[model samples]
Structure formats: structure tokens, C-alpha cells
Target: MDAGTELEDHFRRVYAGNVEAILAYAVRRVEQPEDAADVVAEVFLVAWRRSRELPPDDEVRLWLYGVARRVLANHHRGGVRRERLGERLRQRLTAVTGGDPAGEVPERLAVRAALARLPQPDREVLMLTAWEGLQPREVAEVLGVSSAVVRTRLSRARARLRELAGDELTEPGHVLDVMTVPAPEEGR
Candidate 1:
């Protein structure tokens, strides 16, 4: 194949193979699915522009993940803006829910409140593995860390969540199970 045909094929294959995972990763990081789509678009645009410099498939996957990490960092730097917008959204939601948002169920509210109290990194680790259904290795790739590190973080995050939930949550594979649970629909 000529260079153009080769590039097109590469792009097609990469997009087909990685798009769903990338979008899922982005959704776990960002508040809006639209924002996640934008991040994915940016990642692919960079891949297209730098195709000449692209590595083989395995390395390209890592590179795309790095791009996503940077995109999330950029999003975080706009934290105040996002917070203000979130507050406005919360207000609107409260209004729609008739202002008694908890609505007679204290346990669910307590769980959500406890979740909110966890550190951001812990939450990210939990969301990446649980909600996104990524294996520890893949979670490490997204976090720009090693698999061992991901495993350690996952352990600690689950422990913290269990503590916050006021449950013993102690089982041989409980942490792994927690990490594999689907993410709640509200945030990601």
C-alpha cells in the first residue's frame, strides 16, 4: 500500500479498536459525555496529525492514553469554572426534585455523601476500574503508572470506600469485585 492508503488503514483500525475504550475512559474523567467525545476527538486528531511519528499498535495505545491524561489535566485546571457550573446544575436539579432531594431515603444519601468525601485519586481509581471495566493493567495505562501501582491504589481505594460505607467489606477478592462494579450513571 502507498503511504496514504497505509495511513488510512491504520487510522481506521486504531479508531475501531480503541474508540469505545477511550470514550469510556474519558467519561470516567469528565462530567459530560459530550466533553468525553471532544477529548476522544482531540486524541484521534493528534494521532492523525502525528501519524508519521506513531508507534506500533501496542505503543500507540499507550500514547493515546497519555493524550487522554493530558486532556483530563487540562480539564482539571479549569476546576473553578466546572465547579460553578456544577453548582448551577445542582441548583436546577434540586429545584426539579422539589428541593427535598434526599426524599425520605437517608441510606442512599449517606452512601453518596460518603463517596463524595473520598479523595479524588481514590475516586478516579475506583471509577476507572469499576465503572469503565478496565483491568488493572489498562487502568495503569490510563493513569500513567505501573500495574503494581494500580493494584496498590485499587486496594487502598476499596478499603477507603468500604470504611466510608460503614461496612467491613472484608473478603479475599472483595476489592477486586468492588473495582469491577459498574460506575454509577450520574457522574460517569
Candidate 2:
């Protein structure tokens, strides 16, 4: 029949023939099952788009393997990049807070516990201010709210954190102390 029908038929046949092998290849390579599933989906998407360019007969399976290999490589590189970025952020936070960068500092544990206890909205406002160094107005912009709303949320979040964590929540060297301290009111 038509060119579109021919292409769809070919794509369906290729998918039926190779999806399992591609999935197996991905599962063996990736740590997470979801990641393997993503790899398989991406490989088939590429095949569908470049169906005309697919090799004849059994060569198609080898070509699919090559595509899967590249996808896995990209996935690995992204994971590594994320890990490095997280490490650098940890180092910066450690320098600023004057706490051990390792995960076992007692003050850090207290702060984390207190933060985790807060509602998500309050927690996000505090994190944006303390960790990201965003001002109330900047946080408002990021969160699609008014600056006044952000300030109110920040104040309430601080109060809640103190309530949950007690007055002696963090040491002077903690990032929470530096960032969560009350600010002077705007416009006298």
C-alpha cells in the first residue's frame, strides 16, 4: 500500500523482533530498572525515527546494540556529572557552615532533622534562602509567589523550625544560623 503503512509495518516488525534483546542489554548495564526501561524506550524511538536508515536483515540487531551502548554511556556520564556537582555543593556548604563535610556532624544532623520535619512549602522557602542563597524576592520569583508571601513563609518556617528543634537548634557556625536569623522589617 502506502509509504506510511509500509514504514509502520516495518517499524512494528523491527520492534517485535528486537525490543526484548535491547531491554536485556540495558538492564544488565544500568543500576536501576527504570533507567533500563528509559534506555529501551529511547533506543526504539531512535529506530522509529531512522527506520529508513536501518540495516537490512540481521544487521539491524547489531545496529540497535550500538545505539543502546551510546545511550548507556550518556546515562552514565549524566550520573557522574550529578555526583560531582553534589560533592562540590557539599564542600561549599561545609566551608560556609564551618562543619565537617562528612555526613555525620551532630549539628548537621539536627538541622536536617528539623528541616525534614517542616511542611514542604516552608522547607522549600528555607532551603532556597539558606542553601541556594536566594533573597525573599528571588525565591518568590522562583516559586511564582509574591515577595511578601516568601518573607511571611520564611518567618513562619523559621518559627516552626525553632518549635520543632527548640531554641538551641544549631550552633553559630551552622548555615541555618547565618541564613534563618530574623531580618529587619521593610520600610520602617
Candidate 3:
């Protein structure tokens, strides 16, 4: 294939394959679900612009992961971040305004609140394992750490989360699993 065709083909395959994975990564790191959408867009935009640098086959997913992690870091540094999430949240908010609230269960909210209290590093480790369903080695790839380091971090994160959650919320293997549950929809 010519360079243009080659890049097009690479973009299609990588975009389709890694979109959800990248989105999940962004959501785990970001404060809002809509920020996850901007993350997804920016990631793909970089891939499109730098298609020549993309790796072959499934490795492109890893490349996207690296890009997303940097994008999130840049955003945290107050560098050139956009409000893709703001627009989506506005739409979702408008749809639910002046309507009955659909509540997140009290327990789930508590768990989430406790999670939010954890240090960002600890939270990311827990989320990479629990929410993203990544193995320690795979997580190592995403976070640029050794597998042993990821495991150590995951263990510490889990303990911190459970401690923050307190005994009433304690349920082995399920403490951080609240991230797995979907929230209730409003005005649907």
C-alpha cells in the first residue's frame, strides 16, 4: 500500500480496536466521564497524525495507551486541555434538569467517595486492575512500570481503598468492584 493508504488502514484498525480501552483508561484517571471522551478523541488524533510511527498489529493499542497517559498528565499540568467533556455533560445535564433525580445507591456513592479520597497513584493502580481488567504486566505496559511494581502498587491501593471504605463496606474481592457497576440513567 502507498503511504496514504497505509496510514488510512492503520488508523481504521487502531481506532476501532483501542477506542474503548483508551476511553476506560482516561475515565479511570479523569474526574468526569466526558473528559474520557476528549481523551479518546485526542488519542486518535495523535495516532492519525503520527501513523508512520505506529507499531504493527495489536501493539498499536499499547501505543495508544502511552499517548493517553501522557495526554492525561499534560491535562493535569494545565497544558492546553479542551472541554470535550463539558459539552457532553451539558447535554446530559439538560436532559435531566427539572426532572426527578435518578440516584446512585448510597453505598455505591460511599464507595466512590472513598475511592476519590485515595491518592491519585493508588486510585489509578486499583482502577487499572479492577475497572480496566488489566493484569499486572499489562498494567505495567500502560503505566510504564515493572510488573512487580504494579503488583505492589495494586496491593497497597486495594488496602487503602478498603480501609477508607470501612467495615460496613468491606467485602473481599468486591471493595473496588463498585467501579464495575453502571450508574442509573436520568430522563431515559
Candidate 4:
């Protein structure tokens, strides 16, 4: 086979083998599934470009992990990142979920508000453990912290998130009002 054909074949096999794991990792890490998809796509794109020099089996998975981590970090780097990713995430989410993100809107708003109230580090800890499904040890690897520290932070962060959720959404007026459409007049 020609170099081009060989590379394509190799990449296809690698991609099929690892796509599910990579996708799961991304989805767990990101608040928006669309962002997870972008991360996965970027990881594979990098893999494709560097296909000729890739490592063996699980090494490829590890390399994709590293790439995904970097991609997520870059995606959250600054204010501009939010605006850019927000628009794309909204579009993609709407498309996939049938333009009726309405169902989860209140929950998302409440959680987002709660997360916004948290310190960045605390938020990251909570997100890694709860949203990303990372164990403390895995979280430490992702965050460059000790596992014990991750455990400590995760405890405090979870408690704080609980507190925030209670404080923000338990009141009668906290949610659902906006979702209720007004009835038409009986007689005008």
C-alpha cells in the first residue's frame, strides 16, 4: 500500500479501537457534551497528523489522554474561550437535543450559578470528581496535585456545592416559573 493508504488504514483502526474510551473520558470531563466531542475530535486530529510516530497500543490511549487534557485546558483558558465555546456548544447541543434544551435549562442554570459562586480550584475539584467521574488519584494526575490533596479538596467542594444548591434552588420561586407559559385569555 502507498504511504497515504497505509496511514489512513492505521488511523482508522486506531480510532475505532479507542474512540469510545476517549469519548467517555471527554464527556465526563466537560459540562457540555459538545465540548467533549470537540475534545475527542481534536485528540484524534492530532493523532492523525502524528500517526507515523505513534507509540504502541495503550500508549496511544495515553497519548490521546494527554492531548485531550491539553485541549480542555486550552478550551477553558480565558473569558474569550467561554464565549467561543459557549456559542458552539449551544449550537451543537441544540442540534443534538432537538432545540429543546428547555427540559434541563433550570437545572443547568442552578448548577452553573452554584459553580460560579465557587472558587476556581474548588470548582475544578468538584467538577473533576463529580462531573468527570475521576477518582481522587486520577484527579490528581489531571490536576497535578497529590491524591490526598484531591481527596481533601473534593470533600470540601462537594459540601460547598450541596450548600449552594440548597441555598439557590430550594425556595419556591427559585425555578420552574419561567418555563410556564401564560394561558390565552378566555375572552378578549
Candidate 5:
């Protein structure tokens, strides 16, 4: 067999042997099953990338467990970072709007309700562009689709949102306008 075939066979054997144990290890550690799945995928990705350096079958499972441990640690750190960022955003919004950021504004509530009523794909596409501030091309990468498809979904989603939230949805910025908090007047 060629060197590439040998490497593939070795990687396959290692994967088959340890995938279940790694998944179980992650499932027990992570709060959500989806997070556990992500951990397992990251572990296997590291294994694939370092296939040549992997030890014999007897030791590969232990190696994977080590990789999973680090991956879990990184996942935890990421969660903490996102939480901190959200808190900072809330604080900034409160400072600028001069209102309780935790309280839902009627416009925001209406927009959220309308978004929730949308199909998951449409809602995701819209939020990714408007809320996450990603362009259609970037959203396409996140959703694993062509940019053209993302643009089409965004257009349709906006139209549906307008139908659901008549008069509230406006021109120039659509979802972004509804979602943006107006700054307090200087005198106030």
C-alpha cells in the first residue's frame, strides 16, 4: 500500500477505536450534548492532524483523552469570554440609552417575536447579518452555503419580517434599525 493509504488506515483504526470513549468522556464533562459533540470533533481533528505522531493503538486512546481535556478547557474559556462580552455590551447599551438594558423595549420585543415566528433558516440568516454584524459572505461561511444563497435568504427573511412587523420595519437599515438603541439626548 502507498504511504497515504497506510496513514489513512492508521487514522481510521485509531478513530474507530477511540471515538466512542472520547464522546462519552466529553458528554459527561460538557453541560450540553451539542458541546460534547463539538469537543469530540475537535479531539478527532487534532488526531487527524497529528496522525503520524500518534502512538501505537494501545496508547492512542489515552492520547485522545488528553486532547479532549484540552479541547474542553478551551471550550470553557470561550464560554466565559462570550459571557463577559455580553455583559459589557449590556453595560454599554445602558450607558448610552440611559435606560435599564435588561428591560426589553417594545420595538425590540416586537422584532424578537417576529424573528421567532420565522423559519429557523430564515431567522438564523437574518440574525447572522443584522445582529452578529456578519456580511452575507461571512454568514455563508458560518452556515456552509454559497453567498448567493445567504443573500437570497436574507432578502426573503426581511420581507417576511416586514409582513409580520408592519410599520415597525423601516427603510435604510431594516432589522438593524429596529434593533439599534437610540442614544440619550445631551441635555437629558
Candidate 6:
């Protein structure tokens, strides 16, 4: 197949299979859903640009994650730009709507705190599953490890979060709901 065709196919398969998980991973890192979408878009764009170098399907998902990590790092290094832009946007939106900028839900704040306390690998596993919605195997791919390792990490992460949250963390969807709140306009 031509390069364009091959790239399109790659995107079709990878995105269809893994976009939600990728977006979730981005959300955990960036703390803004819109920014997360941008990250995911950039990741796919990189995949398209380097399609010739992409590995087989089984590895493509993880490869995309590695790309996401790099994109996030670049974003961090350019932090002041995004912060200034966000501040300006927030000011404009508040003036237009006569409302405070949206804040994180309390539960989300707790979850964030708990997640922050987790070790890096544990946090990644939790985000990969809870936020990114990756299957254990897919998370393994993202982490470049075996599924068994992913499961172990996830179990440990979950335990740690539970310990941090105490009883409140036990409910289904509680953590996710806390982490994901409605956008300001969406609340209208």
C-alpha cells in the first residue's frame, strides 16, 4: 500500500482501538480535558508522520503512549506559555459568563492527592486503567512490560489509593467521577 493508505489504516486501527485510553492518560497528566484531546491529537499526528517506523499492531498502542509521554514533556517545558494562555482564556470566560472559573470537585481533589502520593509506576498503572481505560494487556504494552506486571502494578496502585482515600474510595465510579467533572458550559 501507498504511505498515505498505510498511515490511514494505522490510524483507523489504533485510534478505534485505543483513543479513549490515550485520552484518559492525557487527562491524568494535563488536568484539562481539552488539553488532553490536543495531546492525543498530537500523538496520532506523530504516528502518522512516522508511520514507516511504527511497529506491528500489538506494539502500536504502546508506541503511541511513548509519543504521548514525549508530547507531555514538551508541554511541561513550555509551561509558561500554556499557563498564560489559560489564564487569559479564563479571564475572558469569567468576564463573559459572570462566573468563577471551574474548580475541581472535592472528590477529584482527594483523588488527585491520593494519586500524587503514589509512586510513579503505581500512578501510571492506575491512570492507564482508570483514566485511560486500558485493559491490563494494553497497559502492559504502554508500559513495555508483561501483562502480569501490569496487573501487579494496578493491584498495588488500587490498594494505595484505597489506603489514601480510606472508606470513600471504595465506591464504584467514585474516583472517576471525582476526576472528571462537567465543563462549565456543560453545566448550563
Tell me the alpha-carbon RMSD of every candidate.
17.8, 7.5, 17.8, 18.3, 9.2, 18.7
Instruction: Write one digit per residue (lDDT tens) for candidate 4, span 70-173.
Output: 98788767546768878876666555456566776777677778777989998888777655566899999999989999989877876676677565456453
Clashes of each: 1, 0, 0, 0, 0, 1
* Residue-wise C-alpha lDDT for candidate 2, range 1-188, written one tens digit per residue: 99989989998999999999999999999999999999999999999999999898679999999999999999999999999989877666555556544654655667778889899999999999987778999999999999999999999988787667655545543447633423323332
Least well predicted 10-residue stretch by lDDT in candidate 6: 179-188
lDDT for each residue of candidate 5 in 65-170, tens digit (9 for 90 to 100): 8999999999999999999989877776677767565554776788888889999999999888876778899999999999999999999998888778767556
Q: State the weakest 10-residue window (summed lDDT) of model 4.
A: 179-188
Name the candidate, 4 or 5, with the larger TM-score value. 5
lDDT of 3 by residue, 1-188 (tens): 78789779878988888788898899999887887898789889898988888888757888788999888887776533346556666766666443543443666777788889988877888777776678899999999989999888888888887888888765686666556633326443
Q: Model 2, which residues run further than 4 Å from truth?
A: 1-6, 15-43, 53-55, 58-104, 167-175, 178-188
CA deviation > 4 Å runs, candidate 6: 1-3, 81-188
Better of 3 and 5 by TM-score: 5
Query: How do the residues 75-120 of candidate 6 rate in per-residue lDDT, one tens digit apiece?
Result: 7778878788798777666755465434535666788998999999
Query: Which prediction has the highest lDDT against the true structure?
Result: 5
TM-score of 4: 0.42
Error of 5 at 43 (Å): 0.5
What lDDT does the true structure give each of the candidates? 0.76, 0.83, 0.78, 0.76, 0.85, 0.80
Cα-based lDDT at residue 21, candidate 6: 86
Candidate 5 Cα deviation (angstroms), residue 111: 13
Error of 2 at 14 (Å): 3.0
